[model samples]
Target: MGVSKLDILYRRLLLTKLFIRGWGRPEDLKRLFEFRKMIGNRERCQNLVSSDYPVHIDKIEEQSDCKILDGHFVSPMAHYVPDIMPIESVIARFQFIVPKEWNSK
Candidate 1:
């Protein structure tokens, strides 16, 4: 089977000359981190910082110049909300009180 997209995205870029050299290119690094964050993959962000770069994960403070990508950026409210029925129909059926003053038309 082919490697999954998630697998590729989370692949370790550390010790790679290309990645180390491109560390200064925030334009490139930003998107990778952003996508990872969007998908709530904290590991990817941590890997980028601790593995992709020359510095160790523990040396975050020492490498003040490097922008630290934290996985906590992922929203805690990130969860699936399934829609079982049309929102408008649900609102019309379940609305307890309809204001007389409000235009029903």
Candidate 2:
């Protein structure tokens, strides 16, 4: 099945939270930008991050086969990069938020 709207919102929320927590890199910001473009509604995306939109974390966990730990979603499929690498490089290697289906598209 295709990625659902909830999936997209979950990703947006995760990215926004990451940025707020100072874990975001330039590449992560770019990914958020791409997600905004895909949604075609910048205001809605902003509202989503700003409001409690009920993005079901359990559903996301089951769908993506990922686990949310310490407010960070960890994906087994994501590449492992050393902390010695620059934040940009580490962000580039990790695809933690976006679904694989969207990545293929």
Candidate 3:
């Protein structure tokens, strides 16, 4: 029943309020778009922009000064990889590539 509600909502401030910036502020979010951002493609975003979620690539640009929480908008290779993986991990993996020379270093 956990996934029964396919949507969760939280805002940008929640991260700060929880970690470094403390204030007992266990936040209440009307919606939380926790899904991973695909790597920089405009087409996919065009499709998802109409989706019911709040945190899609298209939506971020609408904000006055939207601060990207962790990574950049990754819409390029959305369908190429597994969808079930955590968004952060997917992005981090994509952001970093182990150099072949590092093994020798």
**Cα lDDT of model 2 by residue, 1-105, tens digit:** 366899778768767856558765756555545654645666554553334422223333334644432223332112322233455443222223544454453
- lDDT of candidate 1 over 24-44, digit per residue (tens): 344445454555454466654
Residue 33 Cα positional deviation in candidate 1, in Å, after optimal superposition: 0.5
Pitting candidate 1 against candidate 2, the one with the higher TM-score is: 2
Candidate number with the higher lDDT (1 or 2): 2
Candidate 3 lDDT tens digits, 1-105? 242233233334544546335533232221123323432345655775445523333222223433333233443334343443356654432222323343453
Give the runs in model 3 whose Cα sits over 4 Å from its true position: 1-18, 23-36, 51-105
lDDT of each: 0.39, 0.47, 0.37
Candidate 3 has its poorest 10 consecutive residues by lDDT at 25-34
Task: Estimate candidate 1's RMSD in Å.
Answer: 22.7
Model 2 root mean square deviation, Cα atoms: 17.2
Query: CA lDDT of 2 in candidate 2?
Result: 67
Better of 2 and 3 by TM-score: 2
